[model samples]
Target: DTAVSQTPKYLVTQMGNDKSIKCEQNLGHDTMYWYKQDSKKFLKIMFSYNNKELIINETVPNRFSPKSPDKAHLNLHINSLELGDSAVYFCASSPGGAGYNEQFFGPGTRLTVL
Candidate 1:
């Protein structure tokens, strides 16, 4: 069984469009997170949630919104997508939380803005 999964593995859109990425985890972990992997292969944390409360919000643009409906789901909604938004978005789950526990990442969602 897939421990962590994301929808629409590939996303292609034009600039100024809006998009969303859905993430789900079956690991029964206490915390879940969202990260953006740049072309340089650098992973940057975008958001983190524990017990349905947002714990981390990075210095990303306000167009990016992270929503957690529950402990098992983390969905990212982007408004007015820009070219800079093109990257691989990953969802991860940390057993205890995003603090120091190992994070299991879901297959990334590739976003391309034209």
Candidate 2:
């Protein structure tokens, strides 16, 4: 049983292609999020969702879109992937309480664009 899981742990593709990264958590948390970690290891929040509601972070690109089928799942879809998009995508979750809650992260999905 995986607490958090993402498909294609390592994704290598050419520029301009489209790809989707799937994420799921079984922790029964009310909120889930997507984060991007660059080569410098700076973790940045991309999107947050609770039952399909969008809560995006301003730093994220317009090419990136997040979809949540339910409280336990959130997927990322990218359009016209670029070389700059190469990074590690992490799925995380929290209990959805007041204030900032601690997040549990997935193993990560590394995307490489050539």
Candidate 3:
């Protein structure tokens, strides 16, 4: 019944590791986004998809990729995670690709890289 959902709410891994976070939305939204909130609580957009096309991609580590096979899903894959990669990864979705649209976020998946 959730609008958006992510698996493995907490991820704890060592440095130089790899991880994947799965995200799914049942709201039938066409635009989905992956956001990272650092320790300072400042959220930044990592990637966004609209109709399976990457609409917005912000500056982030090349090891981080947001893969979306469909409109209702966006899965994050991190390779060789570093300590700087530790943050709360959030999955969000909106009706449109515009950033101004009201976004629905799922319970974040906290990634802690030691």
Model 2 residue 77 CA deviation (Å) reads 0.4
What is the lDDT, from 0 to 100, of the residue 1 in candidate 3?
A: 98
Off by over 4 Å in 1: none
User: CA lDDT of each candidate?
Assistant: 0.93, 0.88, 0.92
lDDT of 3 by residue, 25-95 (tens): 99999999999999999999899899889988898878998899888889999999999999999999999
Local lDDT at 68 for model 2 = 89
Best by lDDT: 1
User: Candidate 3: minimum summed lDDT over ten consecutive residues — where?
Assistant: 92-101
Off by over 4 Å in 3: none
The TM-score-based order of candidates, best leading, equals 1, 3, 2
lDDT of 2 by residue, 13-75 (tens): 999999999999999888888889999999888888876687655577789988888888899
TM-score of each: 0.97, 0.93, 0.96
Between the candidate structures 1 and 2, which one is better when assessed by lDDT? 1
Candidate 1 residue pairs in clash (backbone atoms < 3 Å): none
